[model samples]
Target: MTARFHTLGLGAFGLGALALSACASQGGEAPRMAQADEGEIVLMIGLDGLRADFIDLYDAPNLQALAARGVRAEAMIPVMPSVTFVNFYSLATGLYPESHGLVTNAPYDREFDTVFENGVSTQEERWWGGEPIWITAERQGVRSGVMFWVGSETQIDGQHASDWSVYEHEKPYDERVETVLSWFDRPASEQPRFAAVYFDRVDTVAHREGPEHPLVAEAVADVDARVGALVAGLEARGLLERTNIIVVSDHGMTEIDPDNAIALDTIIDFDTVFVPEMEGRGGAGHRPFAMVYGEPDAIDAAYAALDGAHEHMRVWRRGETPEDYHFNHETRGPDLFVLADTGWSLTAPSLWSRGYPPYPGVHGYDNHHPDMAATFVAAGPMFENGVTVPAFENVNVHAVIACGLGIEPAETEADPATVERLTGGRCPAP
Candidate 1:
């Protein structure tokens, strides 16, 4: 029977038609789609700003059940300066922030000497340049699906996923789960070989009320219900055994003390700095931190002032950045990167001058902080059941997914140890 594809919109854009055409032109011998022999379907659900400890605070039947049955990591180390856009790209491209070129939510473009706000509209060119796993899967005729991933809205390699949804504001969790189940309902020949679903409300609300807030717990439970629905859908359709399910998050969040705010105007002149967008509440990237842009001489002066003025902060030039951060070297980030010490945050005068209200929660800190450590859980044939692997880079997820679908990874930055474990230590380096 010929395969059929469909999309169920939840007040957002769909990519079914675009993906189908893109998949057809990428000509290569189609890899064998995983059949029931695969023993499980691969479902990767991303919960934004989900700290690993949030799991213990909330009663997540679905996630807890997965952990009880399969393996759960003690903590998943995110890429350096663990912001959402950077880590998400890391997850997709399996490359460090520097290698992938998306170093921060608002990166400085050295050539333009300006700040580029890494938003949904600008992600196509400003935020991402490396080959993501979905693009690689499509090249091999392995159908893939995406729902609100960081770079999903953008086209890659002249193609996008065979199924996808644009990033949008929070929607009902049940609707999100239903959309994912619908993709799997398609005939086996047409169903996505790999799929990603994103749940942002947890992160959104958590950022406002802190990870321990009642609202945050409520949001997690809501997400759990959605996971239960998706899992049930897979079982009812007999796709459970043939699918692999992965649950993860970007970075965690921490509460910000208004008293601890570091006014940038206090350290540098406002006119000399260029902030792309700073008044749109959460839309603007500055929070828990700030990016300073200036001429080389001016940058040097500002760096010096910040060094003595703010003892709680650390600053570095883009090229001299720490190897652990792995930031893009090519002039994409600011001339200098500033990280506020814990309990302290950098705030812009524009926020107050423009009459925008303040936010209560923020991320964009060193990935090593416990608050920045995300979570990862996988259950399927590609992963060893009830096995907990050591902490590794989130970038390895892309290679693991590619191996599961039997496709060539687009890059080789994935850790050899992680790759071997994901492929059952059988698939050789590509």
Candidate 2:
């Protein structure tokens, strides 16, 4: 079937025209294979904070091989703010941050009038509201598995992935890969129809050391080797061809010079901004850019003050955020959100005292920045071969995966064109 593009409320440049050309060039039929079945296993490997340019810089033989074998997108544009929790939820729910409600790494719940930070354990109720892919799969009687997704610990719609693990930010990369292989070894009866694995070392290392740093390059090469190993293992067991493999990332990284640190004292009142309990020790959210939680009136005044005083920063109100943001109201976000200028970063006072200089790479910039574009690649029986499509919004991932699984998408905000591309234009409405 020929893929049709439907333009949503978001402005359209040439995306629709490009999509149409993509379909027409393929003779109105998405690639197909003999193993195309409903219950085939789907594997998604998330390499956190992997930028599109990394592909050009690094020697990723395995990733390059995957692209050579199957479909690859030039880049994948993450949702607004482009933070971890926000984009991860966007991938799982196929909804923008606004619809999924996870606006930042640390969000404030306006409903309960409370704030949550990185350290807070996300309960089933607090972390997730909309149904994720795993939950929807389980409801359809198809088992699913997750290792360290944003809200894997949470139970959605009274259902969760059959096998799951808690979110641990500091876990070793090798251990995470091993766990996923072990899950694949389980008996077919208990095996998951869908599985997701996350790796943080690349992003973590990049944040501390610049993306060009040898440590960061070493981490990226390590992830690429791990990908090769995982694919080889599946091939050895005759599962590689049967299982669809999707590799993606939350967002990309950019260099930050220490000389560019924006002093918090220069922008807003340090005394009025209440430091919540869940913030990290020396993280960006803790020092120069505190997630302010307080009365709405006070928050509004603070936003206005910062807007006028700081030329490099911008403050967004709870509900007045741009429609493209997809943040789920202020429920899990701060009363006010602040973003620093391109080269500027937030730092704690103690870090300077201890002689610890800030790192040179970061990723929490606005989504429009080209450096923030993440990577997306897919290889399996169901995907078209050697195809490189133009960049699209990251929220469309949820719907694309759902289509591959022959399941209904849990969220409706995904672009229809993505659904058509993934399902061979066979998706039904949510």
Candidate 3:
């Protein structure tokens, strides 16, 4: 087999130049696996938007086996604005969105004058903050294969991962599994000590059909099959015994009533606010919470209009969001925040002159909501077998992974006791 590498950037792909540089090993060839001293491999498998209860609600033998053999957290508490990119970054860096600088899936950074849309600003390394797990492993002289982690595409601090794939959600799940396996099947010294893989169809299905739909049961089975394949492959390569396999989702899903939409224009007079960035009518990515930006006086007017006008949603000025959310970023934050209750969505009434939006499910509600809780399943030597732990914050995961790799995790916003609980006291660090 040949070393393969391809990077999709700006024009056709939303990836950027730094991403191309990230795969510089692609001089018509892919980045070859690098040397690492540790035999403890960490394989992070991400099943996006898999609700905590869905594990038992759906038939998932593979996930059940993993839990039977490893630690299964009661639930994984997500950060404020419990959305994909925010909690994913929090899981990767052991920091809250405020510390990681990606307060939202798509944040507007005033300092760089850049807006962080998925395909647009994702490749801009300047927008990323703190040390992601891949960068952490790389800094410690270990190779990392980031098949498709959320924050893995940039050239941070002048360095990139040992190997990676450009973001492609439509890519088949089998292909994703095969690519990650290729990294592990290598000679022991050349294997990456850390790797991450993602599957989006579960989350996608829930978006279109809602989390309770029977189709989601099928999606659950499909991911279970992927897990089965991963386990089989690792065992075939004789790497399973030494590998630390962890399964986690950034956030979970909640059923949203399509008719239960809170029209932004009706709640807050759109005329008082500017267009474009100002109006995010409770869509999926911008939902349970949507940011509002406008001139100071105009924002004041908008907030007053929204204060008691709606029953299903709550609104707050940017800096004044509930202390629990840690959402107050001076520059990247919007002028005001509007959060919808679970099972409800925010929509742009002006844009909806035609009809209501077609989303049947949504996330991004308060992280404490049971529907917002994610998944955390692990099996390996790094954890005690057949045990269950109470729910903990996602911020503590970075330290746990670092502990498994036997490396010192960088200091961040995580509390030591919280991280210790995630590890079951197996690996301790300050």
Model 3 Cα lDDT, one tens digit per residue, 258-322: 77777776666676664333333333222466777778899888888878777988888876777
TM-score of every prediction relative to native: 0.85, 0.83, 0.87
Compared with the true structure, model 1 gives a TM-score of 0.85
Compare the candidates by TM-score and give the number of the best one: 3
lDDT of each: 0.69, 0.68, 0.75
Q: Evaluate model 3: give its lDDT.
A: 0.75
Q: Which run of 10 residues does model 1 get worst, by summed lDDT? A: 1-10
Comparing 1 and 3 on lDDT, the stronger one: 3
After superposition, the stretches of candidate 3 with alpha carbons farther than 4 Å from their true spots are 1-38, 274-286, 353-356
Model 1 CA deviation exceeding 4 Å by range: 1-40, 112-127, 275-286, 422-430
- lDDT per residue, candidate 1, 1-430, as tens digits? 1111111121111122112211211123332333433322457888888788787889888888877766677778898767887888778878776776776765656765555554544545545677777887778777788888878877875688888776666566777778877776555557787888888878889877776789999988888777788877777665676677888888878777777767766777656655433433344333655656667778777777777577777877656666677774566655667788765777776446454545567777887888887988777665666777666668778877766665656754676566676545644442
**Colliding pairs, model 3:** 281-346, 281-347, 282-346
Q: Considering every candidate listed, which one attains the maximal lDDT?
A: 3
